[model samples]
Target: MSSPSSTLGGSKHAIKLTQGLVALFAFSCGAIVANLYYAQPITELISPSLHMSAGSAGLIVSLTQIGYALGLFFIVPLGDLLENRKLMITTALVSIASLAAASLAHSPGWFLAISLLIGFSSVAVQILIPLAAHLAPDHARGRIVGTIMSGLLLGILLSRPLSSLVADHFGWRFVFAAAAVLMALVTTVLALTIPRRQPEHQATYFELIGSLLHLVRTMPVLRHRALYQGLVFASFSLFWTAVPIELTRHYGLSQSAIALFALVGAIGATSAPVAGRLADAGHSVRATLVALSAATLAYTPALVHPAFGVYGLVVTGIVLDFAAQMNMVLGQREIYALHAASRGRLNALYMTSIFVGGALGSALASPLYERGGWTLVAGAALVFPLIACVHYWFVGRPHAHGRT
Candidate 1:
């Protein structure tokens, strides 16, 4: 017979127990997120084996990003209508199945379909980000969000290099199969550790998604922050998509070496938690502007030193990911404050805008890099953030109202 005190003790233990689970939650999200990126670096390897062209190879990445954009808009809002834990698990299982299908794909069409499924299911990580914020104490929310974002950023950066090594050692098909197994193990851990909390919002799926337009119109803060996040992400997309291509084409470096160099800059992604800490301290809005502006400046140096672009490249990579992750942390912090009971809907708005920026980035990059090289691309990337700085320059300050 456990006394009330002992029952309280167990609950305390569970919250403390949540730290490791939170870290694993972050880790699992990162791993699942990596599924969409394997096609980017390995495009050369994938194209030849399937007898496709370079432009078509890039379409693989573009298609999945498009899928993610669609998911963030459609599937993610279901978190507001259903239990998050169940939604996460179901999506994870579907993601694993998709990976296996991709592994055995005989045509690019088959691979494309599986890639879309992978993107759709990978929103589990996005759901978990807001869920972590919801469960955490308001005081500690930033650090926790940061820690999880770090795991996610690492998974994104390391995905390319690790897949390269795996593809080099075995065939590319094995890469997909191996990822499927890891996602399955992740699904098990998540099912065991994550608590089931039904949504507080009662909106239908259609109602939830339709709210996006209304939110954009009525919510000044959401509109300002959403557009700010979009520009920041656009700058990020422009920088990353161009850097790897320039490194391989102009610098004449091996693919493996460039991948590792990318891994080096991944070191900067650890700033997520720090940004979160700042946000928790009531500095989220200011921090986002400063960090994104700094990243815009960092993009310039990378373009100038085409010869020693490695040094510039790694530095820019760090700033790009760090600032973007920080902005995400800050944006979500703002949204969480604004919508205490409707985080799923708030997140859908923010994420949908950010990913759309990415799709736009990948689309613009191939053309700019092909025609004018890094100078034009870098210049174009910097222009948006400057415009963001100008807009927010006037809106003047954060809103002091709440709807949650």
Candidate 2:
């Protein structure tokens, strides 16, 4: 087998990642990926403050995710076609401008537009993950990917509480302003520390995207991983979106209280590193089943009698996020190993599907909550992981196809 240094860039050896560089990448991922979730916990504040309808305020998050999906399909593929460092830096710069605009917008319409741009540019996180995989030697890829993903998951889980706390005191706009500063710092650090990785693919931009369909058609592991993660992420989005409203309406918890709940949920971030090590040890299949089962069971507490209350909700949130984080690392470890040259595109497809699931979950959160409350939402959320579990058992593992 060729060393990473020998294989990458036709050099004598692969580009080796220093511990400092890995830490920087992890920091950069968390800082930038937080852009997608800061608005989740503060939707109510945003609506009344901006004089927009509740529905329109929800679009702030939805539009941002939609933009992320767009960027994944359209811009993230460029990671394969261009130099990775330059592409990631450019996206970070765009996120800085978009987030600054978001902080300054007075009207809902303007903010919604800016939110989309924020999501779109935040695809920089996706680019960085694959680049890390590219740099790591084959034996250590899963562990490295896991570490960075732990940071990414931390960003996703922590963003809500941090924003809720910031918005509760300083107003919601301040959250974006704070994020812009963080992005600027991340951009500077990434520009200085990240090694340049130019993929050998010479295809034109259009051809690159067009090949996504071909890749999807040909790769069953990609399809399975994408579908499984997508379903689980949908459940994740539904829980987070609806729980904020639930906390206030049912329990009379304030934004600061919700922040605490989010903080507790951050414990799930531990699963990322654990899952990565499991994959590296060739226990990905067992790890995946655990993730699926945990996801399926995560909502059981929420279904119990009302007296379970906030405790159940907190438990559910912790388990739910842990399951999702674990499953995603396993998926990335699986897909990233499929084709070295195509990691960026594979990640694009995998994440685009996951975000699409998230968009669906967010879209359904309000209606499900209004119609049947948390019970209905919990039931719906449970179905996704259950279905994924079935697939993992019956279809995903044949030994002939691939590990989960």
Best by lDDT: 2
Candidate 2: the clashing residue pairs are 4-14, 5-13, 5-14, 6-13, 6-14
Worst 10 residues of 2 by lDDT: 1-10
State model 2's lDDT: 0.88
User: Model 1 — which ten-residue stretch has the worst lDDT?
Assistant: 1-10
lDDT digits (tens) for residues 326-346 of candidate 2: 999999998888777787899
For TM-score, the strongest prediction is: 2
For model 1, which pairs clash? 142-276
Cα miss at 348, model 1 (Å)? 1.0
